[model samples]
Target: MTTAAPDLAAETRDALDADVAALRRGATLWTRLSLDQRATLLESIHASTSAVMAEWADVAATSKGLPPGHPLRGEEWLTGPYMTLVSTEWLARTLRTLAGGGNPLDGVRMDETAAGRLRAHVFPGDLSDRLIVSGFTGEVWFDRDVTMARARAAAGLGQRTPDRSGGIGLVLGAGNITSIPVADVLYELFASNRVSLLKVNPTQDTLVPVFERALAPLIEMGLLRIVTGGGDVGAYLTRHDEIDHVHITGSAQTFDAIVWGVGEDGAARKASGRPLLTTPITAELGGVSPIIVVPGDWSEADLAFQAEHVATMRLQNSGHNCVAGQILILSEDWPQREAFMDHVRRAVAATPSREVWYPRAAKRLDALRDAHPEASWSDDGRRAVIPFDGGAADNLEVVEQFAPVLGVTALPGLGQDFLDTAIAYADERLTGTLGANILIDPVAQTRLGDGFERALERLRYGTIAVNAWTAVGFLTPALPWGAYPGGTLDDAPSGIGVVHNALLLDRIDRAVVRGPFRPFPRSLTALRPASRGAFSLLPKPPWFTTARTGASVSAGLTRYRAGGGLLRLIPTMLNAFRA
Candidate 1:
């Protein structure tokens, strides 16, 4: 009575061809559908995906070698399915508005501040409306608008076509986060008017079924396809003759390989001013994210909250995440460094150790420790928590670890020196700028606003969070998640381009600075007993006093789910008001 599963390779190939063919049929048929129809499709997708939430959690946990019903599993579930649904719904509505001939750029005035920066004041319910939807940073301006045109012209680019029409796109997905590929495809198709052929990473091959089911609406509509396997499949799809554009969310190594091709021939070609191939490839690569803890943070609650924030950033996905805060930069003369380290150590000790899933994670950890023997190790070697002493510059711990580990370094003095040291370390030592977490008190932030902003400006990282973990920006759908501006073929930090939240279709290329009033309660930053409990209880948290409050807050996010804005806002407002 049960049907056998189809051959995955064959199905994937067929799906890819079908999706491309459908997109080649032109945008008229796809664009002609009413906004309500698109919303309905998205709603259906969400509903179907929600039904299998528990199954998805189980698969993630089993694959990662975690105990049954682990808290980290619940964290992944909330992030992958639950948060994705909310983002999709919000974007669907935004698309509906755009399709109705509502000028997305209405009320947004653009001003060019400098050579690389453009400041825009977007009106409510406009194309840039979603910029302020959540905790996202950066301004939004329509590429075709007069202001943007002027800005582009000022930047010395000649008259370029402002074709708003969408086209076919190929999405190369990251294996770390389950929803990245899905979110990227959604951004390209619905938000940017393009059909997508998603190339899944080998690490996430097992989740193909879940993806297929979640994307059934697009699959049925022939607008999206999910393909699996390895390098051969990715190269085949990326080099497809019919492909119009490409977007990848992975490592810089992978991005460079794609752009210049691999091996000695490719390197020679790149050096000779001729790439092995020429294709318009955009990407969001990895980073050794930094967390800056300001000097004047005192209260026990503040310490606890900040410690948890740092731990969660590292522990999430076993530090396989590109946005994980690997470096903790603190002021050595602050006098609270010892207390902070003590709290942080306690938090890490309390966190339950889970096996890292990324290939060669153990080797990478070993390499890091060998390079920096002083680095502290957990009893099981599954985790490393290295705390740097104040007076050492030649220590190995100052180097990048790039594993399920954290390196705590202290910079003496405050004011400009602190800012300068932090920026210098990030620019010179860190591997990438995909994410950064900076913690500053209100007084310090206000007094050092100019210096702090300057430091943020100097930071090469893509997403910089203030007084909160980088994960907040990662979870917030409104942010254009990617690297900083002016990243070229020569320098690939912060990778290239943006993804997440299909609503605004923003073409931003810089830092997203998130300023939270206080550290998030029940944050997964630094590992702690509360975090362990939060992760365990996340799949199904009690309505009250749950550690996975974000998931609970997310559960009632949609206006449709709640009767309207008033109802949906109530829960979020309550959290904010309480905070």
Candidate 2:
């Protein structure tokens, strides 16, 4: 006899229920497994992922409108496989420390500043970190209140407590970054000590197979299950009694909808202090991230170098990154302000535009332009430069355009005074406290002296990078990536909690990252040399909007991912040189 056709809603509910049950079953084994068992499984997972990175990246790239073997496609490799592998390696190191060292900081070195703040030097922690990205440095700045004793006691708080047989976590994956769900699943499993029922985002349904292949080891262990559906499945899983917790990476609005209800009902539920979903939730949400370029006696070269750097932030991935600089805080009083702006305009115009692959991106871009038509560069319609003159500052600062739109807001002042005003602007005006960057030339740094140090202290952000994009903070597995803590279910500006924290610190205030004032070869700052500087320092990155040789870059990156060490490095370098 043939079975009756399954009802769509009923089937979704039943399927999600089974997924939760499987996760619960998988978690039971996790609770009883020793630390050694967890470490060994992670090692196995590492091997599984490493084995299929090239194939996984190729498939993922193709899904994102980037053709296979295209140079720009390497962006997929870096964000997808490279980042996942790095996160896995970091967790493995932590597991070893937790199991073998007895102390989480056994092999790690941490120091306290005179101000009584604990600082853990994370970047360039080893030879590989030093070799791959030279001169890049970052540190975890523990909250000022966290005393040394607390820092030590809370290093591995998750481990300090006995397992309460934690249940399943429903991970609502992000549609943008393909690696987010993979990392989220692993983080839930190893970091938070929970089994995961990962619901793939509808936007990236094509990547489910790659995820399955990479996570086969975890899946077979019954510790993880990947599910796919639309809102019905997500809603069922979110409110299901079996799910002990929910973790999501999306907008703050989505977080509210899941926690409360939607529209006036959500507002009423939030006001009444009663949420539909009782399970605890942690999230990593987007923010209107700012980049404050401190005014200084910058040379023509400095202005050119920073212009390309800034453009790369806004144009990378068609400017879909949550960490991309949303507002450009420039100094009105600086003599080079106009000159620097010229370079910015030139750079943005010169950079090759990519297709708006994101859903509703075109509409969003149109809304931003409609909201403010006095744009400096909006002729292309896709990419724009919104100038925030004195009167229009409010609209520019508050609104976060997710598309390739740049908003420039000029503050009046110079030196520490300018930096102080910019800091205040970010703290009071900006909506979220996710990530912010300060691009201060060494000349400016030296001029400001102790004032520069003070400005760093006052910037209220989860991560404050000097002369670097905030994305570096997000990509660094050792660094905790999240908003500044202290967000409630009622109001989560940048969301709460952190991910990719290898050390497993119980508390973190922010991460301070510093990059070189100038990239490898000074002349290469403008991207295309205007008859000056060095000829070629290194190959152009695939994500650079100006990149013309994506196909070759893709091939070299594939070879590099396929255990092609120095042998592959030479060809990649040559390809970069050619680009």
Candidate 3:
């Protein structure tokens, strides 16, 4: 009779009070199910996350060190479980188009953005996203006081009405993308009809048993739970009192220690705005993104393919991506600015030195090499590259050296007055409005026509991309990822609302995206060389980090997006033509 080993902090407070009383009775049975039972419970959670997505990309590439068949372990199977089965197959095709009454933006395509706002045209979104990423494109843009019949009666999940009162949220995930806590637990259970719990993020505690066997149909219909401990179990489930809301992805110093209250009483409750948690939080956090580039008349293979596309937008995950691309800007009277920075230092020394895997990443790359002590280091002090020059760009444009550091700088004027002073120096010197990347050169955007969409509507950033990589709007689930929407809760900056939208859109303002600066058969050399135009077969981008068969074409495009037909696109087009 040796039954006394159960006191581990009273069995973790009785298993977090029975998982918050089974998510407060599964938040009114997950808002009374419907919408075709939440599209057959997200198609049984996309067939249990496509049958354990190769053991969740082999335990997230062996917890970041990437062991088995590591060609950057195809960035842990395209950012984990193939972006959680592409956000559970686009929010179960927008809950089977609102349970067949239609209007998941019925036949999509809309227009109107010279900044008047209202765009739409979301990705190819058909003919299998134009045969898999062929000349990619996407758009969304809305909030200029969204119209068109209030963006069609506020698209998706019928913008909540009739007493379907959702409640128990909490999430707080993201420990460096293993599908950001299964896309923030399928956006708090099928786009905010709540009933979640998630937690996880103790650097992804081995993906909490592969997210409880891939979200066992929303934790066997108690809606969801999936806990894990650390930071006092996320400060006792963020002051748990049957938690009503709180999103969080991570870091704005943990969203001000969960809305003020840690050291020195969270700096006197964030300087007296008094918030020890009123429980209505939402965040995404992290900044210093920028990439810019816009000069013109390029080609030494377009400056070695956009300097390996700006070293795969700052060495992909090794830059601990919060929309990576940590500053590169450029222009300083562009005469191929030092030959496109000598092919961005040979594309950040030909990509492959990884594993400084997040947590204190070598003491933040040794405090960014003690504030750029003549930067350029690599032989495993884990890549640097700095540059700056111009009052050394105010400490890497407001510190966000997540690691694998890039920096660069420049800025002056040329075409369209250098893309309007690099879009007002990335909207008043970049820190983070989430994402931004520009590149240009499709004949310098047809010689800055309409000053290249008024420099993408004067870039404020919440997914910009163009010539692609705001981590492709965080692996596109019909794009909407956060920030640039008047952030608050005491100066949020890059920590506000929005998440993998999947057409449950409401007021959203950004998400542009575009691609094919060159890559397939060198993008058919922009359709028969000798100048600029563009076409696409779209290769070389299995999320590039010098992609040579980025781990068998991101594990054969995650079993051809978890359906595996047409012979899994003949081994993902023969491993993306061997990258």
Candidate 4:
């Protein structure tokens, strides 16, 4: 099987260049547009995309080598248009508030009466209150001073300073998730008043058309641009003389390379306390995300649901995601370890072998197996569920495997032992800190609350999700997503800073917390429904017959169209949450 080199045609290049120029112009106009005008345009874009959800999903699925009605196809349906609509709506409302000269953060009061004395409270019925309150843990607060400062700076630029009117921004898009780069560009243009040049990842060229169409409103408005190619293209745009600021979602290696330049000369320059080039770049990099399995008396349904949840985290986008749960930290003495592992293995084996998107995934899995030959293997390369017996945790396989592979390490003893072991493993190994997933029951939360909190505090990861996968944190626009805060130039594992939903925040670099959800249900886990007619409407649902999948999907989507709003959104959100 020979793979052909990518063809970068002159026509494509010209289109990309035109789009870039359009975006550059759009950015200027976007800044000048009254926030209400911008909000109106955003609404139009959302409405347009929503109207053609199935078409967009088909295109996205076809590009990814999936059938027109694959479950992953629904990703574009749910995450792409749905997310765009939700995010755009939120941004539009936020912009309206900004335009009204009313700070969205105004209702959240914070005071420091004395040194080291901090008090924060939210006014009832405020958007800020509704926005920050997490369904998982109730209320979430940020450093109000830092958030206000950034908001003021962003707001003041247009009003107080004429020179800061057109801020040039460079957006480096993520290769995996289709919506990230698009959302990043939108945020820069609308949320922060920055003119953006979007650099598409080499791996995600298929999404270029979708973005082009979805963001046409912004392009017509003269506020956003889309550019494509590989390293040369990225470097050219990032180092372009016109770009004022940069934002990227990729690996820490990529981030470091951009910031310090690459190779020996770059290293020397970095060591000399002089960056090869000076451009402020914000990044949301990868992490050695861990899933902590607390000791619990889980039911069969619980085990099955969790297995599917864990599997979904790995299998989504073929495990190329930055927020994928890579590690499973469990208690060896826990009676459910064997049962959990069994359930996980069944889930992995049940899932079809998806097309591995990342080039080096096979190599990474091979390396991991070499380090631990006893590791289990499925006939299909899509699954690797390896559990370690009681032993040392200092191996390459234990450290990382960039594939649909999971490393299971068992900690001896009870509550403190489990917490200490997880912390030690995270501290000793793990590569990045984009986010972590922790599965804990109410019993464990109560028994190990202090220890788990302390462990969370000690853990190096950025976003921590208790009892759930960190992917939820990424999907939910309410939370900030990035590297763990407080990391410096010396230590880059956790990377630096934060992105996403920090609409008004600046100082926050990391978020660590837990989620409270009922134990998983079997209906959410199984691929096949017991009844034929029940889920026949879902195209390519685990149970769908490939030949008739199209009709089923059409029927289901028709139902969705007929009964729109909360009725449709509720089930979709539930499915996404379970996934």
For lDDT, the strongest prediction is 3
* Candidate 2 lDDT tens digits, 162-198: 2655578889999888788988887777667788989
Per TM-score, what order, best first?
2, 4, 1, 3
What lDDT tens digits, residue by residue, belong to model 4 across residues 178-271? 7788778766664456877788887677767777777777766666777778875676566655567888888777877777778997788778
Worst 10 residues of 1 by lDDT: 533-542
Shift of residue 349 alpha carbon in model 3, Å: 23
The better-scoring model by TM-score among 2 and 4 is 2
Give the Å shift of residue 94 in candidate 3.
5.6
For TM-score, candidate 2 versus 3, the one ahead is 2
TM-score of each: 0.78, 0.91, 0.35, 0.79
Candidate 1 wrongly placed segments (more than 4 Å):
1-19, 26-28, 31-40, 105-166, 387-402, 501-579
CA-RMSD of model 4? 7.8
Order of the predicted models by lDDT, top scorer first: 3, 2, 1, 4
TM-score, structure 3 vs. true:
0.35
Cα-lDDT of candidate 3 = 0.80
Candidate 3, 431-544: lDDT as tens digits:
768888888878778766665886688788888988888887788888889888888988886888788888888888888888888877767757665544557776677787
Error of 4 at 187 (Å): 2.3
